[model samples]
Target: MDKFLKMTGFATSIISWYNINKRDLPWRQNASPYHVWISEIILQQTQVKQGLDYYNRFISLFPDVVSLANASQQDVLLAWQGLGYYSRARNLHAAAHQIVERYNGVMPDTYAELINLSGIGPYTAAAIASIAFGEPHAVVDGNVFRLLARCFSVELPIDTGEGKRFFTNLANELLDSTNPGDFNQAMMELGALVCTPANPDCAICPLRTMCNSYRLGNPFSFPVKSRKTTKRDRYFYYFVHESDKQLAITRREKGDIWQGLWELLLIESDKRLSENQIVRQLSESLNMAPLAVSHVVEMRHLLTHQNIFASLHKVKMPEKFNLVTFKDKIVVYTGRENLTDYPLPKLIEKLLAQYFDLPPKVL
Candidate 1:
């Protein structure tokens, strides 16, 4: 317990640093629950720089739960285009609608109530509760894990259940009740800015003097994790069919990756498909005789647990199939001009940038 209090003292230094040197981000400017909620959702498993634009755009367009709920799913998804993890956007949309219908369009102020929303989990609920509502709850994320592991020299593998339970208890104990939000933010900020994953800046770090890992000259060695994912190689073949100014696309349904977003015709295989197999699959999916395959190219996309080797096949469809009415899975984009208005997965976007004569810096 004495050791715990001593370690928690690091929050003071972290808070001081944060007050002076925190980045002037949009979300930090106003502590609006709506804005904070959107930012938290966007920043999950995404970098700050990348998530910033999406955060601003979402707030500017939606502004509040009512507006977000009233808007169409298509509109919400269009606003969320280019941001990966389509499910986040979908879940956020669902939560917004739920709030409007059930809670009179007002976001709940308590963590317990917020957790009841469809998309929010414990971490998000805690963050919103503390940062937006000033409710006392600890935010224990990866950054906090790094700071805690090194500061206390804990050896429990962070990826294990015991480690998670132990750390959550420790974090709750350390959290400053008076300023739980600021304290939590300060810890995360310290880890992100000074106690980085690689080559941590110990000189500027406030906890350096007291950090057990630093004193042991192996701060990086703490926060040990158990590796669980086994990367599997996959092959994707995308058929790009363009006629006039319109390009063909499809909406990925639920139960598949990149679900609820638009994509090009895709063929997935365990083994890399031969050129003939690619042509045959495209023919079957498109329901057209194999047209002349003009351009065939390959690219690679990396997901967390899988490696995707993608092949882009540019084909001119038969006139009969070219005019085939699009179902939910098939639609036509009116050139790159209207592309931004539709929700598309990153994989499809990458394929478009290559196949279409996209303008400079369109993405």
Candidate 2:
């Protein structure tokens, strides 16, 4: 078959399969520019099933760009609590403000303009442009990458710049320009539901007839990556100082993980430390001795590039002491009941639920 004819058949099969088999999602119900943008951002590092509730809540809270722009960053972060990779939330908030300011509360329709907005990368911009604005841009997310790599049996490392460009161009060539929105969604849906990373269901795939990887019986081997991630181990000691039903908390600074989120007073170390070492460091940092100290809980939190071994300890302060007098400028005292009002890291949230008797958040 001629290359163009073969590609047309592939796209037609994908679009037909999608129209018949696509999942009925809330975002698909109304592919407004705002809805698509929000859904895409939320789904960046998250699965569809996990992001659904977050999306509903987020849309309910800030239904449009103007509302999102007007809301406080803390409120946005609070709504985004459980969905980690907090930078995405922050960037979404930033982009909302940008859209409001630059475009007068209107989402830019062009791919070039959308890409310039905060947190809107090539894939996201393409998604919005094609899905929301009827542009011919092809989205090349992990799903599309895997689909194209397997269909053509491309072995280039996806982590490399060369591999990215090749796959991107191929996706553009294969895109059905007349129906870019459904076509893009179809490509992604097929990858998510059928061409999964582990044990793809080639039997139901529309492209299986032309999939080189299926013919070679190595569907899992085509989407190759050159780089291996090395995760660093970190130890976090959280001292929950309570006095008169108040708990000490602090906002994480800009240069670290969970930035802009609130947490208990923390002492971070590169390596795990003994109890005596923890106590000595706490004393030195706080500039006073705790009346009593006891371990509460220990949890292992995993991030993309880091493994955090967090230990929570209860520290009893003197009855007359003032938290404001502490040398650590970030420390602040809040009512124990009000901890839920502030956005907290998942580890801290779990600690509160398990050890502090706080009700677990449903969303």
Give lDDT for model 1: 0.81
Each model's total of backbone clashes: 0, 0
| lDDT (tens digit, per residue) of candidate 1 on 1-363 | 466566655667778788887888898898888888999899887888898988888998999999998888889888887777778888999999889888899999999999999889988999999999999889888898999898888889998999998888888888888888888778877878888899799888887777888788998797898877799998877777777757777677889677777777677899977778777776676666665875566778888878988878887766645634433265654576777776877777777777665642383
lDDT of 1 at 87: 81
Distance from true location, Cα of 355 in model 2, Å: 1.5
Q: Pick the candidate with the highest TM-score.
A: 2
lDDT of 2 at 221: 87
How high is the lDDT of residue 250 in model 1?
69
Report how far off residue 140 is in candidate 2 (Å).
Answer: 0.7
Q: Which ten residues in a row have the lowest lDDT in candidate 2?
A: 320-329
lDDT of 2 at 7: 61
Q: Candidate 2: what lDDT?
A: 0.89
In model 1, what is the error at residue 153, expressed in angstroms? 1.4
Q: Which residue pairs overlap in candidate 2's backbone?
A: none
Relative to the true structure, candidate 1 reaches a TM of 0.93
* Candidate 1: segments with Cα more than 4 A from true spot: 6-8, 323-336, 359-363
